[model samples]
Target chain A: MENFHIDGSTYIPRIDFNAETGVLEIEGESYHEYTTEFFGPIFSWLEDYLEESGKEITMNFKMSYFNTSSSRRFLEILTLLEEYQNNKEGQVVVNWYYEENDVDMLESGEEYADDVELTFNLLPY
Target chain B: MGYMEHFSVKTFKQQLAMKKISLAFQGIFSQDVLALIGKSLRNTPESRVIAKRLFAIVIEMAQNIHHYSAEKQYSEKDGRDIGVGIVAIAEDDHHYIITSGNCIVKTEVPPLIERANYINGLSPEKLKEFYREQRKAPQREGKPGANLGFIDMVRKSGNPIEINIKEYDETRSFFILSVRVNKELQN
Candidate 1:
């Protein structure tokens, strides 16, 4: 499968999904207007990738800021990964990175970690 | 209060100035405009925590207006209709007050007031629980705001949302919302 990559902007995150290595990373801020439209293709890509590959996947989230709607989308992504891991398709490891001083981001990561059964790690940068 | 007394532009302007409002904008709340406002807030000299809260609140408030305001404006940049509203940030010794006002259909006042009152009644933990529950639930049809922005603003500010609804005309009312973020960090 081909890789998926989208550059970051002032209000959108950068998406880099490497099909070969199974490393999916989203970094930066996400507060765009068309959140559902923007994430649609990314969700489709993940579903297709998970179906095609049996390799272990690593997901990295290094987000500085994201609005409420984006927060829901992120939770959806984590839930999808949890389901993948639960079904024994392959191992899934999620690394959620936040700035050391951003307590809100840190708390958000903590909450996400609590909401899913996947191997979630909260890393500070 | 009577319609004319609901919002006096001169009095409002004086109140904003007296409250030491640092930034104010009145126009279409397009995504581009929201980004510019975010940039300005980030550049403010407040502590990182306060700045972050301010940024989040501003986005939520502006987006609410963009989605639900009764006033609409066609934006050439966005190639679509956007909401028109007013937003301001004022600072005192202990708090930064973020206020936003927009026109809304008179019929929307009851439900909006109910939602605000419900959110204001919740404790911090309950607010967080409510936020997570609503986030997990499917989006309600035809409701883009989803009340998540309101919950989030209150949760982040750790304060009750103050709302004022005044009849603007026979069919429309003016809705004003203010959220206060303590300058000192809360545990």
Candidate 2:
């Protein structure tokens, strides 16, 4: 019903969840002190959005890096998206963007894709 | 000087000389200081890609202390707790050695050592598989992570993770872990 946008910080990523567009984007590095505290609402927002809206969802991740805690959180987000994709009529697509030269980041995207059921578009820019 | 102190100092100096210490810090580990260190690393030699790798390892190591260190002191500004630890980065021509140490309960040492060894033993493909499995695994209660941080460290280092433990007292020990990232990765 509502949009969510939080600017990136030294330790956290930028999050933009647009209700109107049904497009959610998270970019930049995330190594926040309170990982769950920061991501709890974002998870809930996605849950509510999936239940409330009849629109397709597109999730984009463009992270240069993220710490271990944030890594788990991203996995959780992907798992949720996979769940929605499986049961819901509205489609869910994920795009993971990494630097072309970053082998680790590219592998990270592949790893995330491997865990979830949804087909992830691994984009290098 | 006591045997332990003398040995530690000597070994530390040897490491410094061998690796050409780029940055070193001891005592409190705080987010602000970590940010400053991360900022300074951006201008380092070779490539930004390798810089990011080194930075990721440093952050994981520092944050491990912040979350798990047995010794902690509260901050003045927000009264938020901060951990006591040591972290250093040293680079030779071929690799960057990032080391971090913190106090931990003596009982925790065995499993920590075992975990590090287990990760070191995994091949690259196995390590990636292990990492994926751990990501989906439920979080361990009380621990900040599901032991995923160590796996990530091993995966990024592209080398065997090294760990050393020194008994501090009857109840505590210092756990030191190091990860080596290839400088050639910069190319």
lDDT of 1 by residue, B1-187 (tens): 7778877989977987897998999999988888889889887666777788999999999998898899999999988889999999988888989999999999889998999999999988898889888888987777665459999999889999999987788899999999999988889
DockQ in order = 0.63, 0.62
Off by over 4 Å in 1: B1-16
- What DockQ number belongs to candidate 2? 0.62
Model 2 C-alpha lDDT per residue in residues A1-125, reported as the tens digit of each score: 78999999887899999999888999998888668888989988888888853468899999988888898999999887777777776678899999898888898888888888886899999
Q: What is the TM-score of each candidate against the true structure?
A: 0.93, 0.91
Summed backbone clashes in each candidate are: 0, 0
Q: List, residue by residue over B4-51, the lDDT tens digit for candidate 2.
A: 964688788788777689788886667777788889889878788788
Q: Enumerate residue pairs that collide in model 2.
A: none
How large a fraction of the reference contact set does each model reproduce?
0.49, 0.65
RMSD values for the candidates in order, in angstroms, are 4.3, 4.1
Those runs of model 2 whose alpha carbons end farther than 4 Å from true positions after fitting are B1-19
